[model samples]
Target chain A: MPANTLTDMILGFSVIIGILFLYILSLTLRFKQEKRKASLKNRRNIA
Target chain B: MINKPKLLTVFDILTALTLLGALALILFWTPVEITMGPVQKVFYFHVSAAWAGMLAFVAAGAAGAGYLITRKLHWDWVSLSAVEVGLVFGLIAILSGMIWAQPIWNTWWVWEPRLTTTAIMELIYLAYFILRSSLETPEKRARLSAVFAIISVITVPLTFFSIRLFRTIHPVVIAPGGGDSAFSMTPCMLRAFLISLGVFTILLVDLFWHRYRLAKLNYKNQTGEN
Candidate 1:
């Protein structure tokens, strides 16, 4: 029988997916933040 | 304000679905290696991520060339976006590789040639950001950053051939006679591996496009705002 590395496999996938998730989240947040800043600048200029 | 393209939305959905399908196939369809067991499965996406990361750097280098010839910030956006997305994929490859090594190598880290070269390559690209932020103007930043990216790309091929050049415990998956670190793959395993590579490449393109758009927006905001 091969050595059981099931825990390591799980950990590997989790880390891979977790990193992707976090990066995607950060990308989305940056877009929203940029949009908000644009809106605020527009409002100031109108005033 | 730029609106998101409908085609990009469709492409994003397809990429996500393909990624899920690829993961499921890897987990369920590929047979476990009798020697290494389940953890051998990590090799599929692990190597694929590394491939995507390298491809990104190459794209960045090509974009750098485009910037130098045309002097367009659009190419700069491509270069910057590729490096950013490349770093993420490179980090994923390194971390996933460490996990795989833990069980196979009986350690979390090693000073082996392949591993060391990879870490160095990642660090070289990471410095691209620091170099960009130090410049006083956008044109200066883009011009210098393009040169840095073009020069730093040497590390990619160096990292790639490290295992072939020197003795290392790292697996030589693509090398012939794959001594020591090589494992023979069954047909099913090969199919899954190819699918994973395709999926990751698509993911890399999607991420680069999104990032390029973000770079454009960031540039617009920095320059257009009073």
Candidate 2:
């Protein structure tokens, strides 16, 4: 419970949260990319 | 548009709740180690994340086997999704372990078997992505990646056991002194540990599902684009 080791705690949580955030961001990016592809396909069909 | 599964939505909420609960428990509820102190708390999640990441690698191998035998796109997607998730979580495990090690071991890294094997495994899986990206055809990409997945998985157990056996000689501090102490767990710590595992597993499933869906969509679009 020493104050010194608190840095590791912060670093650990930062890793956990940072990885989650990166995955979520990745999901959003992929979703958008897929959406664009789908929409473009639809426009081509309409044409 | 595909309907989001009701169960997965429920899982997302459950995952969030349990993970938050586990974090609170670790940060507030558990007794600080008398010697190692607060930083030791990271050990729980570090070990759990490493375990789950290993499991994900195994899942990728299974997916790869199914794909090779059945030649199903779904199986390929599963393998690919697992690889991606495994990479993310694996990196987390390594980083967290290193962070914990810096203080306890007085070294940021060691040339020990466990760390070395894990690093090698990460590189192998990372190369899977690079290989997939280089290919233009979906069928060839899937086939090649599947083969790589299965081959790469064989290294995981080798990595684990190699580390275990090597640890016996070096007698690292992190290694539990004996079988009984290794198995020993207080009820509170057990609860917190299990809860964290459950949350991480749920989170993995959710991410895999979402990634697979995106892959499916991408595949469909690619076919249509052709």
Candidate 3:
């Protein structure tokens, strides 16, 4: 139970959380892009 | 325009709350291990992510089988989403496991059976995506990817059982008989571990749903359909 092990724990948790954040961000950005594309296509079809 | 389902909205909130609760338990409630210390706490989320990744692969394989039987587009979407999400989770598990190992195993990497098999599993799924991208037609892509997904999932079980089957230094936390576990769990540690698993399971489902929606959107865009 050395105090230095705390650094490993922090690093481990940071990596996990950081990856999840990047993933969710990707999903969100992709979703928004798709929605915009779909809407523009619909607008052109109506015009 | 695709509408987000109300149930998914509810699920998103619930999953976030559960994940926070799991983190609280892992960090604050669980007692520190005598030998491994704080780094051992990473074990809760590391194993849970691995479990979730394995579950995702199973789901992908099942959905692939479903597509082969039914020739439905939805099944293909499910298969693709599961595989993609599974890859992300698997990567997290591997990286986190390596971090934990550095402190405990005195090394950052090892070519142990469990580690090697898991790496192979990740590569197989990566190959699945490559296979999909190389195909020209949607039908061919779907069909080929489905078949690949089904066949590659054989690695999942092999990866899971590798430690049990081989003489590896990797710890077997949950085993049928008393296993060569590196450390024994106290009741609080056990509770935190289970909670982390449950939260990750919920998170998997939530991510899968979002990924499936993205796949559906892509399919619609490809087909020139709203």
Candidate 4:
């Protein structure tokens, strides 16, 4: 049981950590986009 | 119009700190199970994912109710975001369970109550997205999706109870006399498990807040352009 599962452990850990990294990347991209949009709106108001 | 609030930035830092702490606790501090050995480490994250998945589903249901009462598009966005995130977490839970099971259960798939019910719940969540995608009008999509979200949540409790019942009838098949899904944890293991749950919940809240803010900004942009 334990012998065959080494790969499963690696796969499971990878998936969990990979998903976390993906979510963090997504958040960062979203923050940038929102900031740009806000700035654009501000410039529009000034013009 | 506004940046992420100060509280959210603080949450981002807290989330990072807690997640790193959880990893350290699980990888170094926790004891391995006698029966399951190293693979048992997956249990902490599996259970945590399940918790966050259910929490997201409940949030979707609540937001659906709010939309119905208020008839606000923002509530619809909240409901949609909750369901989307729930689907992602729920998929992780199911796949992680299957991966863990293959080592212990000698099979990649099981008709066990909990496993089966979770699979079914994931399906219902997938259907929610499909239902939303099929609609063209935003107002109609919001109303129909809200209705679907409310109606779909009814199956969650039923799925849970049915699985509990399924477990009762089947003789313990996989692990031992009690059941196939049993795991015995030492104090360190238990602490690691609890810590993982806390970290996952915090991560879920942080993501939800960000998703909601993005949706709100998109809405404001649309309204302003119009």
Candidate 5:
């Protein structure tokens, strides 16, 4: 029988997918913060 | 300025769906190897991630060249974005490779040529960020980083060729026949491997585009210009 490497496989994929998800999350959060700051700057300029 | 393009939205959806499909195909459709079992599944994505990471570095170098020629900040943005995205994929490749190695090579790390070269390559590109952050002027930052990006791309080929050139335990997947280090994939495995590569390429492009947009936004915000 093939060795039970299923756990290793799971760990590998989790790290891969988890890292990607974290990056996506970071991008979304940074974009939001930047957008808010830009909008607030525009508001202050208009006043 | 904050309004995102519809095309990017479409790309986002496409990337997500194709990635999910690729994962499903890898896990469900591909047959486990008789010798390596489930952990062998890691090879497909691991190699693909490494390929994507190398491609990113190549893109960064080309973009660096573009900036040097045109003296355009947009090309610098592209180069910066590629490096940022490349670092993430590189991290994924190294981490996944380590995870897979634990089961196969029976070790968490090895000082083999491939691994050593890859670590060096990653560090070299990572210095791009530190170099950028240190420069006060945008123009100076772009010029210096562009030069650094161009010079550091040498590591990509060094890391890639390390396996073929050196007698390392890292498997020679493409053009196999590095003696015991070669891995001859079956047709199904080859299909999944090719598809994984394609999916990862798409993912790289999507992430690079997003980063490019973020760079553009950051520039606009800091300069108070549209």
Candidate 6:
């Protein structure tokens, strides 16, 4: 085998992993933000 | 704070372990192709992502139909979450497919039926979001988006069969009658491919669950209901 396509394989895997990581990060951040807002809203209603 | 389910946590660990196992099998177990060399390894994840995306779209369509039949808000959430997650997997498949194509096809993209239909399917789902955003009321938004989701999913089967239906350079690995696939898979290669598909399926469910929770929270927040 020539094995010359190492670069392309690396690029493909990097892009797949990178996109998944970024998406998970976005989901986590949004979940936290939403939770905080909901809590604050509950507190205000109680007050 | 909403308590995380114990089963979800267990599923998270399972997905992570299976994904790591799949990667190790691809890197160390599968033999390198004499012609395509290392880049052939990309085939495992590339195909897996595309399969997962297709499954997600199917689920979304089913959920849409369920919403229409029952008029339940949970079905609406499931439909939206599946589409959203499906978009991510679709993007991965397209980008990875492009990378693989550049080396094999000597071009970044071609107007082949498979490629063209996949792009169109992605666009249709993208429009699904735009349609949802345009509506103000929850009832109207869910109803309209559910209809759109159901109709748009007709493209999923079209996209899947495009290579078989048309003359194209894209490889069809699992086609009937041993269609025009560029390469044949050995036992080890087949094992790795199956493992990758399984891992992606698990990941899809995990992400869909998370996204559904987010959608539920957003719905509750918007309507100020529990």
> What lDDT would each prediction earn against the true structure?
0.90, 0.81, 0.92, 0.78, 0.92, 0.90
How many steric overlaps are in each model, in order? 0, 0, 0, 0, 0, 0
**Top candidate (DockQ):** 5
Off by over 4 Å in 3: A1-3
Pairs of residues at least 3 apart in sequence or in different chains that clash in candidate 1: none
**Deviation of model 3 at B105, angstroms:** 1.1
Model 2: what TM-score?
Answer: 0.90
In the range B64-162, model 6's lDDT, one tens digit per residue, is 999999999999999999999999999999999999999888999999999999999999999999999999998889899899989988999999999
Local accuracy of candidate 3 as per-residue lDDT tens digits, B61-92: 99999999999989999999999999999999
Candidate 2, residues B60-144: lDDT per residue as tens digits?
9999999989998889889998988888888888998888788878888888887888899999999999999999998899899
What digit string (tens of lDDT, one per residue) describes model 4 on residues B67-172? 9899989899899888877877887887787788887778888786777777888998899989987987777888989988888887677655664455443222
Candidate 3 C-alpha error for residue B33, in Å: 0.5
Per-model root-mean-square deviation over C-alphas: 1.5, 2.8, 1.1, 3.6, 1.1, 1.1
DockQ, every prediction: 0.78, 0.62, 0.73, 0.49, 0.85, 0.79
Interface CA RMSD of each prediction in angstroms: 0.9, 1.9, 1.4, 2.4, 0.8, 1.1
Error of 5 at B220 (Å): 0.6
Query: Which residue pairs in model 2 clash with each other?
Result: none
lDDT, candidate 5, residue B213? 83
Between candidates 1 and 2, the one scoring higher on DockQ is: 1
- How high is the lDDT of residue B91 in model 2? 87
User: Per-residue error at A11 for model 1, in Å?
Assistant: 0.5
Q: Where does model 2 sit among the CAPRI classes?
A: medium
What would the per-residue lDDT of candidate 5 be over residues B17-99, giving only the tens digit for each residue?
99999999999999989977899998888999999999999999999999999999999999999999999999999999999
How many clashes (backbone atoms < 3 Å, residues ≥3 apart in a chain or on different chains) does model 1 have?
0
